[model samples]
Target: MEIEPYVDTTLDEPLVPEPPEPGSILSESVIDELNMTVWTLSNGVTVWLKPTDFKEDEIALQATSPGGWSNSSLEDHQSAVIAAGLVQQGGVGAFSTIDLQKALAGKAVQVSPSIDQNTEGMSGSASPEDLETMLQLVWLYFTSPRQDETAFQAFMAQGRAVLENLGSNPMAAFADTFSVTMAQGHPRSRPLSVAILDEIDLETGVDFYRERFADASDFTFVFVGAIDLDIMRPLAEQYLGSLPRIERVDSHVDLDIDPPDAHIQKTVRAGVEPQSQTIMAFSGPFDYTAQNRVGMRVMAQALEIRLRERMREDLGGTYGVGVTGGYEQIPEESYTVTVAFGSDPLRSEELRGVVFEELRKLQVEGPSQEDVDKVVEGERRARETNVRLNPYWAAQLIGAKASGQDPRFLLDTTTIDAVTIESIQEDARRYLNEDRVVIVTLLPAEMIGRP
Candidate 1:
């Protein structure tokens, strides 16, 4: 007997026509019609709600607090991290870790907490039906955290174990070592040192959670899904409204450490791999800056094109290359462009010279119209694809509004179409000059020959 494949020849209804081209300057009336809705809760927590009538069953909610390692006292920075790790582990209100797990097990509710250079945070998801339970758990986790001493000690031990493992891991060690060589004395350079574990104690964890984490004014709640604003409004008031008042809020500090015009090369052993690559990182402009803002983005994309063409395609020096610019809100928001790849042990300096040559060319002649048009078209296609693929893109718009950006900026083409060849040249001239580049090469100990 022969089996045949079956085809369902059904055709779906067409979608509404795509919006008009966003090339020209966007007007206030056009911006006003953009569908990003935001409101402040009675508890002083700003909430951005985006209603998406997508077909997906699950929704993602990301709520972030503004102060991470940068704002905390160096001693207390890791403490902030410690508190975040134990958020769900130490139990909230009457729910132990096991109990919380059991309550949401089959329902697909997840709560995770993390801390970074700029913010300490918790965010997770629940089914649309469990939104109330999700918010309640988050509120209790933030407000009535137990910070059990045993759990804190266990986590500290785990952190120390992880650091010891990093000593044997080349990639992990590169990040820490290169970060120190790049930013040096700035707050941005501060890594989670192994010594941070020694400094951990029960009292410190409790203090960081109670004195630092409990402040609701510093926190924001973001809910995105098939949400009913009327239903969630009362739930927000009942759960989040009761958080302790924090009159004083944590503020951002700048980490603008412009490195000197020198090449720094170093070598170390990671007890594992004998070979690894180095990363050359340079600071660029923040997203909200004047011409420098979007200019830096175009510049980074242009550099990626050059790097891919010269380093990968032409010379075959490395497997891949990437350049990106993003707004990292604090130690004060700034832009960074990093180029990284594994190197042949002997060709490390040669690779460095090639990189400098490409950057120099960019600074001098500037990119061609063909190059500019390629990136503009690529960026446009990527954005359109992302907007169509992810329903959460709408939620991202709302989150950006809550984070204090004009939501219409996403819909505006001025950022991309306006990125002219001259603009890219100007930004490269400003930020990627000889004095601004910090070249960090991590080679094997034996390969550390003079440049």
Candidate 2:
């Protein structure tokens, strides 16, 4: 029997479906269990501990150092971030990565580093039996960061390989272009450039670790889960107390947020996926504002719904669309709403226009009662769910308190219950003005150098 030939016609069919957005109405009981304890060490290390009363076989630990790109040079910041990846690769004191692995072998201890634009730190989890060794490892990375040049170059080479392959990824290109356009000339603007990577000589790595990167004064230690203040205090005093007090350099540069004179389209074509991406950035007020934060949360939820309905359901553009606010605390605190969607380059202009029109509608006419209620309900549910799923929510709250932001915002029933619809409309009116927005379009490189 001969099988019939098949012709693929699915491409011509509309792909996205209009599904009811999940959990539109939030419940109240999820908000009750938010609790935490904060302990301040004599040496200035703030610790946040939240115990799991039911008793898990293992424990997780996480600590964050708040001073990120705002506190260091682009090159040094990159070096410090990248160094976190390389720290265990070399070794500390007398141990190599291999030796350290062998030491922790068969034990429930694991350590890793996480670096971000505004923070750099390490985290680990261990069995109650191995907590001391876990903390010791943490101390090693913070105190003696072994910046071996050979290992760093090898790591950089691997990074270059990954970057070269990212040439084809539409999302990666969008991210690259967005960083350049939004943060140009600012410390936040700089990504690891080829030129900078090329200049990473042996001395660069050594000086980065020994001098500017891991200063004790810029560090904050946070421990969560099954920790005793008395037992850990001496260990902390010994491991962390020895850190020298040194004045570190600050990395801040001035940049403007006003919309560009003309809308611009940029491209990075040398990649595997030659698709186009659009990034819609609108002015958002500083995040610390109670009104703005509440407004921003509601507005973001409203925008997410708008994008889902308009782009995914109405236009059938892509599988997903995301909108997030870029809230920075240093290098001058500011805010921006970045929305990106995946699509063909030919439709880039249409996508941009539709997004702007949506923004205009929000500015000219306030969201409907239904839209406002839906967002408020969605955000309230989200905040409540987070408090329940992660016990570390308490640590995060306490950390915010340690940094001077009131943690009460999380637990304050008055604050959560008091978010008014008028407050949402007021923020939209104040910050969503088109004059303050920047529209950036990034397309494939082949499509570029043509128009």
Candidate 3:
């Protein structure tokens, strides 16, 4: 048999099979203030349901629970980190990769499971008509994950090809060193390399994945879209409620991943292209709360405006600049703020001086009233739009749940509406303290007299 790339476009028919039916569920409680419904299955799974008419035929779901690579034992640590990616490559349940594709030839549905530093779960979407197939896939993923050796070897081979001659790209050298330095010698923080391939095996990766998703008691599944509470209840209970349930207390383990304690600086040289880049990072311990999180967001937005003004507009040194800073709640309560941009190697020193000058201004005086107002206005508009979207609600609830943050904060707009100059300055001083800072400069390789 030969493969055919052409489709039979002349046929007036859909190749898709029939969709699955909905399930029944009982509501535990309804919070009118949040306009949300909650249900607890007999098997210990929690479901958060919010109905919306945003899209006529769309729904988004995010199921999450505590425990990630951070919770793995030393023997399974490396495998756990890449477990989600590897497991997904192999087909789920009783379907081979090709068989699964053939089965889902014309369906608008997708589901992916992933494990990060502090969380593991499923993220997927489907039309209301196909919700049953979506849930069916979910149940199969947890109960019967396939361990196909052929798929595993193929994934490994692809990995080797990607890692081979990776250093040929200049950014590769700079990025590798930057990651190792930020990890501060934490064994688990090492970047993926060829050696990692040897340390991790197919069976170990699949085994770790099973252990992470084995228990559904701690997981919270949020469904938002055009939903009929009456129609979805039974389907959710049948597929999701039936997932493996075990009695266990699970949480992310602290591997002591810390940034440099003192101010440190390093320079990297790579590639032949005439380009250079610089990154300035600052981090320290701080109060992790909703109000503080909003405040930090405001400060970062304002700082970016000022940097864009000076680095690109005033000096005309680079094309653009970016500032990213936020507080972490899981495994540790800490903050990190970083500013980076590209410039000529000769002017790198001059531009370096400018970066610190801006830093000093932000630390002492904060952005202008106009800048603060601009940031708040933009944020208000974004929130206004975000609150109406389903994905926004799904991400907010699941992320807050995973990080141990207060989900009630999702409805609070007082902080964003009441942002002041003094508050921005205070947040800057508190989180971006100078004690913990790492600066890295990336310059082009040698070239003496090229005109």
Candidate 4:
């Protein structure tokens, strides 16, 4: 038997390239701490380039600017959200979505547009050889985003279909209630519904997308992995440098969204599954600092370890429990700690008490030295491997720039030493507040006889 190598016919006869108009790099800055270089283009686009031989064929890129949909009208939040989403589905430049796919058939290049609460941008990857193609797509997304009515209609139809049956799902009902309750009546925080979907217009989305991406002045572009500075500089200039810009920079606008300052509990009964689920949350104002951020994670990881032991290993109450906690600086400086899990409908209250008792114990007596050390050791092992990788560097590099943190911290392991049992206990006391706790539980609808 003989096997022949596969050939991509599309690649054998490549489509004509749509190269960006020529432009030049205006200036450069070297952050000696991180061994990365930053360049400002003639047209004001900033690029952070980190060269690494981590992977021979890998390059990851992210270009983001402040002023996500929140910067748009809060009343039109759904439209702004849909606009960011439809850009990728609709198409870019002269290519239809299908045409673009066909054109990119054999290229190791990909990119997608996104809009989040405080930022909007593109994130994707390409092989080193396909970097120029990646740049071309980036330029097209900025210059000429196309709209497809068919795609728009299909997207909305699918959305409507999902919303139509959402009321019948216990998890969906619980989530909607949880989100609305936590957001404290913020209009922008409402969950998806037929009414919300009906008010969103594709045309409105397209317009908002254009406005958000219209200017590249405030955008910071990050590229990492297998970088060839000599090769990328000109491509960046030609593609990103030539992007349209007005005399404007964008910043995130807070919609004043925040969780409430009081404790409350609510239960939703739905579904046929004979089970119980609960989300116990604690939140309050926070002082967003580097030390506090790491401390919060240490506390959460330690708590996760405690929960797995008390609720799973010892009590045999359930198979697993989930614990997550983090602080946010945007809109307001605040933090949320959430513990969630499923268990027997009869034992839900008992399990909930276990969680509270463990939390209070940590706050009073602190985690053992072994628990703190485990978290630090795990972080060390992870970071040891992460430092040699591309995506980690890509994220951390951008994060350092965004937070004004010293880039040299990327190499400083001294921070981990600060994670002691005493510190963890102090973090528990400082951050976690039972006064702000919100407990939302879900049980079998028939079991509760319809709450």
Which has the greatest TM-score?
4
Candidate scoring better on lDDT of 1 and 3? 3
lDDT of each: 0.63, 0.58, 0.81, 0.85
Model 4: runs farther than 4 Å from truth? 1-18, 448-451
Sort the candidates on TM-score, descending order. Answer: 4, 3, 1, 2
Which lDDT tens digits does candidate 2 get at residues 1-451?
A: 9998995332221111221111111111211343444544443455555555433545566666555433445556455545455565666645555556666668888877555445555667776777767766666665555655566667778868876767556666557666666654455455555655564444444444444335554455555556554665555555555444455544333334233433445555544444666667765347564555566767766767787789789998766788875555544456777677877777777777777777667766767778887877776788776654333563565356434676556565455455555565566666565666566566655764347
Candidate 4 per-residue lDDT over residues 358-427, each given as its tens digit: 9899999999989988999988898899988888888777677665567677777777778899999998
* Candidate 1 lDDT over residue span 1-451, tens digit each: 9988996332232111222121111111222444545656555766666555553455567776766555556566556556566555677665556555655557766766656555666677767777766776666666666556676667777888888877666666667777777666565356666875676666665566665566766566556566676776666666666656667767444445544445455664443334558677776445554345567777888988998899888987788777775555445456667778776667766777887888778888889889899878887888776655323564465346445776655666667778878877777777665655566556555444434
Clashing pairs in 3: 23-233, 23-234, 23-235, 24-233, 24-234, 25-233, 25-234
Query: How high is the lDDT of residue 141 in model 1?
Result: 64
| Candidate 3, 1-451: lDDT as tens digits | 8998986333222222332332335448886776788898766788988888888788899999888888888777888888988777777765766667776767878888889888899999988988887888888778777778898788888888888768477787787778788888677767677887678887888899999989987889998898887778778877877777888999888888888888888888787777888888888876887888888888888888988999899999989889888678878888888988998877777887887788679889988999999999989999989988888988898887787666777888898876898888887777666667888888888744423
Instruction: Indicate whether candidate 1 or candidate 2 has the larger lDDT.
Output: 1
Worst window of 10 by summed lDDT in candidate 1? 19-28
RMSD of each: 11.4, 13.7, 3.9, 4.6
Runs off by more than 4 Å, candidate 1:
1-32, 69-71, 114-121, 186-194, 253-276, 284-287, 290-293, 327-329, 388-403, 447-451
Q: In candidate 4, where is summed lDDT lowest over 10 consecutive residues?
A: 8-17
lDDT winner, 2 or 4? 4
